[model samples]
Target chain A: MAPSTTTTYTTKQWILASKPTGAPVLSGPDATFKLQTVTLPPLKDGQLLCKVRHFSNDTGLRNFIQSTVAPERFYVPTVPVGSPMRSGIIAEVLESASPSYKAGDLVMDFHLGTWSELVVLEAATSQKLAPLPKNLSLTHYLGAFGASGLAAYTGLKFAGGAKPGDTVVISAAAGATGSMAIQIAIHLLGAKRVVGIAGSDEKCAWVQDQLGAHACVNYKSPTFVEDLKAATPEEVDVYFDNVGGHVLDAMLTRVKKHGTIAVCGAVSGYNSDEPMALRNWFELISMRINIKGFIMLDYMDKAPGILQELIGAVADGRIKLQDAETMVEARIEEQPEVWMRLFSGKNQGKLITNLIV
Target chain B: MAPSTTTTYTTKQWILASKPTGAPVLSGPDATFKLQTVTLPPLKDGQLLCKVRHFSNDTGLRNFIQSTVAPERFYVPTVPVGSPMRSGIIAEVLESASPSYKAGDLVMDFHLGTWSELVVLEAATSQKLAPLPKNLSLTHYLGAFGASGLAAYTGLKFAGGAKPGDTVVISAAAGATGSMAIQIAIHLLGAKRVVGIAGSDEKCAWVQDQLGAHACVNYKSPTFVEDLKAATPEEVDVYFDNVGGHVLDAMLTRVKKHGTIAVCGAVSGYNSDEPMALRNWFELISMRINIKGFIMLDYMDKAPGILQELIGAVADGRIKLQDAETMVEARIEEQPEVWMRLFSGKNQGKLITNLIV
Candidate 1:
């Protein structure tokens, strides 16, 4: 592949047109993310212009919108309309003005309002990507070794207190973050039991087979609580809460004394006007459980260490990265539909929107 | 006064009447604790016959009739119908067959059931009282230096994570345990600010004045939330929660990041058939708070150390013990009315029925 030059090019971009209502629609009064043609912004002296190859659609972005429902309850606004939608992206640097990188360097940058072909990111915010190891695909880095991987690592390490012989239960177990957490708990931390609670029987099998989980229970089962109780008879030591609602409440009821709950995202209530009633929260006091909610942006300092460990794990086959690649080379008008597919649980793994091929 | 050698004295005793409905009435539907005159049970080789001097009434005693509640949840259960009521008491050893204690020695024992004039206790359960310091009253030892003192010390030390400059908030601040916790936080731990949340204006004032609380708020006020917010703008660092319904819910909203909440009791919900609803528990995750429910019995190993520290503080006048002494010297049949006073909140401090004058 030949290296490309830094050229000012006009590309179609999607901008948040409206705030979302309950269960965001593809096109509605709540959201109208419109596609428009705009000139690529010029890179500053310490910035780089990169061509975004893969853009991420994640549960956190959905939560970012609902956090604004009750502004006083949250520390910050969820997401603002008329702004570039926040995302994580893997891009190739075409132009660099900073000492950190050159024209042909590939980097993982979070300046991914990357519903676009080109993004101008500051060198400080742009992370130079290490060469993908043999047999590892570039899309794997965007999913498992990128922001999602680091989030799982730090969340389990700090909040989950992942330790040997512990039982870790993860919601949304088939998703990038949850799958990463399951692998980290089992392979890295020597967890005795890694249980996954997913939405379907297929995801349950994937979590157990592909992610190396000891057991996986479909939370959609009418007998979900009984199955979870049977699966985790010793009670969960660490709960990696991703889809927080009834699953979270059920998990709380089964947490062992002095257990830790890592609240990564609340996908179940993300688009709802009313937040789910967590009836079992009183268990927190009785069981001495520590439930901590966090955003990965707060732990940016640990990113390098996380990426190194993840890459090493993948290369050694201790961790498997399953990239659910959905290549979309369509016009910008189809962006909202692509993003909405994530909420429908159609994507088995990381839902990456490939802007160019 | 010289001690008498006669251990065969007959005394009238109150047996557990039928349990009452709603607020326990003096007269029960089954049988008001009948006046029973029986021969005293013989003391065993390792037991002492303790002539009950004072029997304390606490909110925990109410849980006995509710068999559905956990045995570990309360201090003692109401006496089973026709059985002697169990309680904590200050008694004098009238006769002893144990090497651990001598006849005529004053002792504090957990077998209060002092609705009777005599009770038998094992030597291991009774602590021989030091000669009451000329400056310290024996009643004060029973009130502050007994279980209440140990509860405060343990709550602050283990559960509250209390440090020198941390702000400590105590609920039910005028009650025996809350008052003791306030003094321990302020004087023993050197907390920067000790706030007390009490039920009445007078009790709030007493918490600040007698217990050395930095400030006190009456939670009964319509502006309790605002008043509490104004009182604790820095946010609560340690909350020793005794009354756990609305007070705990309100405190949850104002707890600082990484704060510790010691869930000592849920007196507010003790009598309610429906559990209190706490809607803002999501703050626990956002603030990274640690809320733990504890029973002093769980930390009994630290009892001797707690007693030494608390006794020294009380003797030195660093910690003041306020005696909410509602003296009742009545016949055994009057026990029901005495027990009823505690539920009405009519008793100021420790409600003790003085069997001896």
Candidate 2:
């Protein structure tokens, strides 16, 4: 809260120290972040100050730093060097000079520079999240009910055109968006079978046993293709592709006639300089598959309805919030390390760093 | 006409002699066709005998021969070696035993073996075209009123979703379907600027001057990309792609956001053992371009309506059958050579063979 006394607050943030050479690491000569503190300026007439509660890590952050040479090339606004990293965050208002936001207001900023101890913005910029239900945790607001959740839901509904009894497959099935996509395919869309592609046996087990998916395959396993085939004998009707590359190619070969691929992310190639060589692209014509690449920004108008349905499903237990059970939590200082877990496949479920206790 | 005497009739046909080593040749070690003769069998119940009047040469004929080793892979059935070459044909009924047809009837058979002087089939197997309109020739039934016409119309209307004022570009713009596509995009679809990509300057001139396309680019020129850029300053809104190789890749770079690419054919790769390397396929996701590869067989139910509209357009001079001017007429015995003109980009317009005349 702002004090009448001449007291000032300083904000700590993780800035883009340098571009990563390849896949990012927390402690290396090629490390891509630097921590810094800045003195907060007086609140402007339309400005509001927020204390970051929790912010979600995204593979897109890697793309942001690497894509700085051509920020306009990406869908989202890229974070400039020396600027605090941009991310989706759930935050509490600490001070407000605007009529729209008051102290203690919980807001979700999809475009905010949130890998920091504090965020200050015009009240109109961020969306005030609805009050959390008693049964659902605030993590749901960041994972299953936030941008990642909306990505999974909209990508399936709009891109994949998820229908009842469709055999849906999700890559990166242990990640925040993929896990939600797996459950959405089953509970909301009534998919006949759901296959999850993860990177480890533990993640695969959790994806299958904890998430109610029909099967889960470790993509790192030698029998990855065989396992995927065995799991989806009828062939995939909707492939919610989060990890594009070899996984996308494999699904392309197996997609049923008129199947759709919801390309939400390409995590596998975000760190690489070369565009992945896709062999099975010809199948896009052969099987008459529809490959739609989309971002949540394109589906903002549909977000409210999707969020409502997702919240209702999670509350009614139709959607098991398995991401909460295996949650990976870290402090604001560990943002780089926690985010690295996403790239290294060490993170379990939704990876978030708590900026405030 | 049936023979007045009880003399037996022998039908001459072109049969698949052997698979081509590469692109087929009419007279070489790589010759893919052979001439054969067989006595016409007596008409059975519900059967009719017809003499092939004119047969259309399609780029798909190349795929048919190449796909024979694995016939099930292609959308249409493949022709076996030693069997008559199959194609779309306009024929005249010589005799009939079914009530559906009678002697002297004009029929259109999409799946008939047309590289022959005669064909016999059940009356239900072919559609009896109405009496030829006074303003139209028999070639109209095989071009503007037949499968190629439907391919162009359906590709632009259904697959491309071509709309008024859209900047439509058609690859292989001097070929059969592309020629019609150029006109349909301008006259029917009301595209503001239609760009045609042909292989030669003469063909490009005909595409722009005769076919009413706003501009035509000779793709074989070393400055093809620059020429295409100069021609389509506003960029492409709908690309009716008949050639899928470097040209398709080039178009992908110039396509407007949310453009549609109707994959009608890939003549560049038909005879080559190597799959054309496509580098810009990622644009399919970035631009949210819809790339649909289709066969006319999928839209046969809509063929009649398309044919009716096309016939009206032809008669009204709305679609300049300018293609009729450059028609490549070949004897039935020269089917192999005429078909090579499709891959070689030597045929000017709708390539057809005179079977009876």
Candidate 3:
């Protein structure tokens, strides 16, 4: 789409109303977000006015919106109580104040809030991207070729020391990072066996059949424990953990000697008032296992190179990512419900909301 | 002391009678050990007939005497119901068929059962030591220059990555391994501040005053947690955990980013039927801590050189072990009571039983 013809522009944003109690509220009388409309101010040099086209509904905002965090416990700054929520979005460069971008050019803003329909981005944070048809999907920049992809690549390389012929077990296999991890483990890293743990039977089937995982176990199933055992006859060498809790404890009992557990996220514990207490920590000593946690921003220096590698891999059909992307057509007002899809396990693969009509 | 001069010498041995219900029973009706008497046999071509002079009473016997262990959870072989309990000992060779050892030579046996007054050792397992004045104390070999010493040295080197000016916190600071760890951390590893955790005020004083630790905290004190906090104001760089459970949970909250917890021993949980649960596991991810468990046998190849280094250090007055060697004199029948002192906190430093008289 072309830039809007109107000379004046206004946008609606969801601002934080109160500190969260337990989980963040998406709707109703107790909703944490208060809707506000604001007129755009004159853009400064080295800035671009962008209209958000597609935005990722992710758990990143949940980590930063908390009232207070211990200095050592958090990696990023906490979102102020009245500030607009932030997310990753693909936006169109409309009425650029900077010489680097022109009108109608598409860009990816990894952290700029898409709660507003129109956002002003500094040149430093805005990444110029190739337009549609030449690129696989605008959503791909926010999903496979973005932060999710970088986490999967580096978590394995640095923490797990992923090598050829290794057996990897990935949790939250239907989610963004886990799905990418499965493909990277099998296709790029040459893992001998790749087993995935997902939330539902349909998600398991898609993970195994579509994402090329050797085996996929539905964690919701009654026989999930038995199924996981049957899937990996060879013990797990690297466990890429996305949803920590009972899954981490279970993997603790199943890892090979000197195995590595790369903790990418803890979706299972993020919203709970009390995070799960792991009882099998002694296994760390008994098994000589090494478990590590990582945030994506830590590896941004290596992102551009890996993003090109991922783009080339997808362009050459070396890695399959399209089948794993689950997108929804939603405007700015529908983001709260779209983000809710992640908690309900209703979204398959990477959940992206398309704002374009 | 001279070798036993009886032609037909009879030896008393303690054999495991039954599986331990919780902690092994000593001298009661439900005692796990049964006494046996056997006449000494002639030495074989590759064996030595040795008179056990001094035996180290250690926690090593507790792990193997259990009826069964999960294959993945255990490193050493489990002692069958009727087998003798083994420990490290310093002994005098009475007769030898192998050319490597001769009559009256002192040797250290790291794994041979000293539940007997007399025993046979394979030429392969026996380590010949230098005669009296050339060696510091016969008990020193069992205390700081033996398995305990090696565990401290290697646990720091490989697991904790002990470096100059590191703030290393050691638990069980009055016990054999922990005392040596304090010396190794300060003198050898060049630790800037070493805080020791011991079971009693006296032990803590010895750890601080005698072992040259910067500070020492009594874990039994009512204000232990606060004392520990006051002791480690700079925060812990490496925690040498000899006692697990709440101490582990407490230290989990104190470690600096990228700090290590070398799980050398878990004396707090060894005899309990159910091990204590650790609730602060999320700290591992939040603090990015690396906690590892290691055994001395894993580094036997490097033990000889480090043992020589320990001997030289103690000899040159750089490391102190003289105040830490606690000795007991009793016949073979007193083994169970001596072992119980370790659990009751009655024994301090390196408890060695002298069979010289």
Pick the TM-score winner. Answer: 3
lDDT of residue A233 for candidate 2: 85
Interface RMSD of 2: 4.1
The best candidate in terms of DockQ: 3
**What does candidate 3's lDDT look like per residue over A86-166, in tens digits?**
788888888898889999988888656557789988877788886434557777878888878888888877767789999
| Candidate 2 whole-model C-alpha lDDT, 0 to 1 | 0.78
Residue B252, model 1: lDDT of: 78
By DockQ rank, best first, the candidates go 3, 2, 1
DockQ of every candidate structure = 0.21, 0.23, 0.29
Query: Listing candidates in order, what is each one's chain A TM-score?
Result: 0.89, 0.92, 0.93
lDDT of 3 at A23: 79
On residues A1-357, what C-alpha lDDT tens digit does candidate 2 reach at each position?
875863578988888877766666566666688888888877888777989887777776776777322343356677777778788787889998899989998887777656888888778788887766765677677777886789889888887899998999999999888888889988998889999999999989988888889999898999987888788888888999888778876787778777888788777777766555554555665666777777777888888898889888987888887554345556778877777777888777677776644
lDDT of 1 by residue, A246-294 (tens): 8987887777877888877777766666545544544655566666666
Top candidate when judged by lDDT against the true structure: 3
Per residue, candidate 1 scores C-alpha lDDT tens digits across B1-357 of 887654565767776666654455555355545668767766678988878777766776665654233334223444577876666777888888898888888887775445677777788867777865546667665667777777778888787789999988998888878888988998889899999999889888888887778899999999998899889989889999887777887887878877888877666765555445554555665566666666676678888788878878877888765464456785555666776676565456666677643
- Candidate 3 lDDT (Cα, whole model)? 0.79
> RMSD to the native, candidate 3?
5.0
Model 3 complex DockQ against the native: 0.29
